[model samples]
Target chain A: MNKTGRPQDLPLSNPRADRVRDVAKLAGRPARLKRGHFLVEGPQAVREALKLHQERLAGGEPGVVTEVFASEACLDRYPEFEDLAEGTNARLATDEVLAAMADTVNPQGIIAVCRFVDVSLDTVLDAGPRLIAVLCQVRDPGNAGTVLRAADSAGADAVVLTASSVDIYNPKAVRSTAGSLFHLPVVLGADAAELAAACRARGIGILAADGYGSLNLDALQDENARRRLTGAGPASAFDLGAPTAWLFGNEAQGLSAGELDLADHRVAVPIYGAAESLNLGTAATVCLYASARSQQEPAHGETTHE
Target chain B: MNKTGRPQDLPLSNPRADRVRDVAKLAGRPARLKRGHFLVEGPQAVREALKLHQERLAGGEPGVVTEVFASEACLDRYPEFEDLAEGTNARLATDEVLAAMADTVNPQGIIAVCRFVDVSLDTVLDAGPRLIAVLCQVRDPGNAGTVLRAADSAGADAVVLTASSVDIYNPKAVRSTAGSLFHLPVVLGADAAELAAACRARGIGILAADGYGSLNLDALQDENARRRLTGAGPASAFDLGAPTAWLFGNEAQGLSAGELDLADHRVAVPIYGAAESLNLGTAATVCLYASARSQQEPAHGETTHE
Candidate 1:
């Protein structure tokens, strides 16, 4: 046995190992989540955790990873584990034990237990961010993950989850994010008032997308018109002040009346067809992409080839 | 029992009942689906099946309802069952029996066995003369449903799914439509070339949404613009030609090269953020809504509070 009391032998597979597997599943619960602990399954999530760990190390912070496990074969596959070996307490377990710990059908052969970092609204602003997405009461795991993935792709600073939003660390949500959860700062359980205050303090314009909103998103794309619209910056630039928060609501009931009332402006995507509303995740992507379009310079080079 | 020679009385809490349920499950298989048969469960889907039957009756077409079963209380609550009694056979079963036949938990107290309507591309065009969503290969059920629901909300004439697309009648797809599937013409397994040819014959411009396309969606929305954006109507009026097909593709692969080649013009939603792409459903919704916006007349009158 190793000093930590776990077997040092290359794969610990036994009936007693069930307790260890149960510990990984505990990460799915809210209580464990609140305790700042999460289980990273498979090599993909663990590799991402290690990447983040390295970034933190370079930035002069203690590595965030607490524990890591793999079979001897996994260790053999990744022999150059300089930083990982030094920082993380590694354990060798059997393939059966790893599979038992994994939530997915195909395990990636590596798992890590890590501490969740608290990303405050200030951290997002400090990251030199320009755009952010605020999800209000979005309960579906798939939608939440898609939004996170979209936010990361849009180069948004962070994804702020308002009260009642699905947990970011939910295995399904994490899986859906396709590794974007690691790349982006995800703030959960934030209150609307907190979000509003943070945006207000950051000089960020809060644009709420309501179906009834008078402002057409297309009109906002007009470079000269948008400058005239907001009465700020050059005609070619989008000047919604320092930062911008695009607020999205639940899939069924969109942004509430109270939330709409707090927005500096209300916007709507013009619809010609019979759809009552766009899906919540899709709407956020469109809105975020629209904002990005409004702010960026026109692209050069061959756009599309035949 | 009802002269069909099939078992009319379902035995609840019996091992044999499980086999009957298994038989019902087999009804959703592709062979059965291709043969124009599908199982309906819960009150909503069953109610929709009945309504479709009624519409067929009123239209002088052969009603495709094969079987209907309900608890005594369900029959009493619905009451309007003259056609159900006259045209198709009906059976009264215990709640447990009904549950055994049903696919969902808390079954809405009803179930139906109905023939799927093989809605043809020509029939879809004949029904409506204008807008259409021609899905190239949307493989996600949720995305397909969202597009269909969006098409319905946009008051689209029809939603045509090409080969390789997800089954529109998949329970998840149906649920995602939020009942819009029942109202709209959702024709599945269409040939892309045939659809493009049909739309061309109708003078409907085929606008494909390509991320790398040269034409911007906003540019198309402008009245003075000369180059036509795919899936868009003429600038002067909201009336998009005779009919238009908005082609969307798979979530990951997007529109195929051959599919893009068939389009009248490739159009794109400009992105300012880092997201490599929008989710398929979001892309379709945005483009579809953009087309809808282009067709909308200026809203007038005092905006009523909701």
Candidate 2:
């Protein structure tokens, strides 16, 4: 739709063709950064990317998705893909060409080139978010993506990935997100300290999800129970139902003392079994769901005294 | 430890050796079945395998661990591996040979050959399980492995993979378990319908985890709340603390209608966000944790009335 003057006219068949090689280069971080583009593979992610692009275009902004490549079989099965690309860019390629353009061993017949979609930390902060997930130095792509998906599923306003975290544009992470990446704002390269300060300034409580935290999650639940039952209410315990930002740390080292000190509360999801710990992704999901459940519950009136 | 009269005297340096090829072949299902053995890669899995094998050998049963291959560097770093393998078998392998025996890009310096660990359905059922995870037609090896890990972490008694599910011994699944394969009993290739019937006969409540079920998990928690608050309890609503087996389904199709009908109650985890649904592993974690939290709580007196 940008009309850069060159239009593809033929169905690409050669996997080693220059165009295919250039597109395939987007799989790596350096190339993606250099070209200012990333690859979106598979029908689900492509569909979501196109939909978001259309919304941006209608809002008078530059479209994020620049081009789509699909095989004839893929187009035949999902003709709506072609219709979606009418105002943008589209091309037909052979299965081998499409596979070459993809990162997976078995690509499901479609790929898209899109501009980087990360928003600034200020933009995320200025929105006055009610729920957000902050990943500090998360290294695994799948874990990062799953946490993003869990945050999205919990209806978080955004996800902030600190500078040391794995690149969100990593193909494996994108694949693991299962389209949730396009569903919400994912802020990258944020400074953890600055983000914490920003949340504090916004009157948003920060809860650090740490394995060794002194505060047990079930005890919090029990506190909520006693508060509700005895009418000794909210002030007696930290209220998860309030607007909050959850800070999760590196999968291996978890939060440092400095990082833990930055939060309003440090909470641990109780481990009832013998296994050493919950996987990062699973732990984050349980935490997010706890917040979601708590926030959805009807608010109990707070007592003036603690 | 079997003392088959063939003691390995020299370090194995050839990656193309026939013994190495036989070990590598265990990565495939056919070879695993025919040889009645599978490859357990990396130091963590190898450690667990050797420990379990030692336990079996002590109990006068056939050892599960057949052979352990480790680089001298690895054995030097962790002398425990050499000690653990003393009763069984241990061999020095060159880095190249170790890498060839491994399924991962980096095998972390060790690999072990172990017998299949699946127990009979009757064995699992006969134990009068307090908690169990039933996987019905779960096809993704990663998801299956993750669910197994979560089940183990929650202190579930065992994990049963139905007949149509992915092979639990698949190298990818084994890797995803992260050494949890040896943590608890994992029953494979079970019939879902028959398992449900047996669970019923044993007085274990079958709670089918369905995305579209009318009974919301939050509502179940609310019922628990009322039971706790009023003390007029137990018989009116399902008690998660009681003996229960959770039934989960495939990654894509979920549970079929017939599968849903087989359970005593169908439950859904409440989705608070716009994201479609929780992935299989995350959903199972939340469900298992809920039961774990309930069961771990001090028991409440049951009402005699139905």
Query: Chain B TM-score of model 1, please?
Result: 0.76
Summing lDDT over every window of 10 consecutive residues in candidate 1 chain A, give the lowest-scoring window.
A297-306
- Model 2 chain A lowest lDDT segment of ten: A297-306
Over 4 Å off, model 2: A1-17, A229-237, A256-258, A299-306, B1-10, B58-61, B230-237, B299-306
lDDT of 1 by residue, A1-306 (tens): 123323255566652465565646645776455667766776656766777787888899877677777776766665544345455777777777777776666556677777775488677767766788998988888899888878776668788998788877776777667667777787888888777887787778888987788876655554333243323333533343336898888877889988887788888865555345666776777677666544442321012211
Clashing pairs in 2: B1-B88
* Candidate 2 lDDT over residue span A1-306, tens digit each: 323322247688999999999999988999998988998999888888888888898899999898888877777677677667767778878899998999987679889899999999888878888899999899999999899988988889899998979999999999888888888999999888888898888888999999888888776865665455445434435877778899999988998888898898899988765556778888888888888877775542222112
* lDDT of candidate 2 at residue B140, scale 0 to 100: 93
Q: Compute the lDDT of residue B286 as modeled in candidate 2.
A: 89
Best by TM-score: 2
DockQ, per model, reads 0.28, 0.44
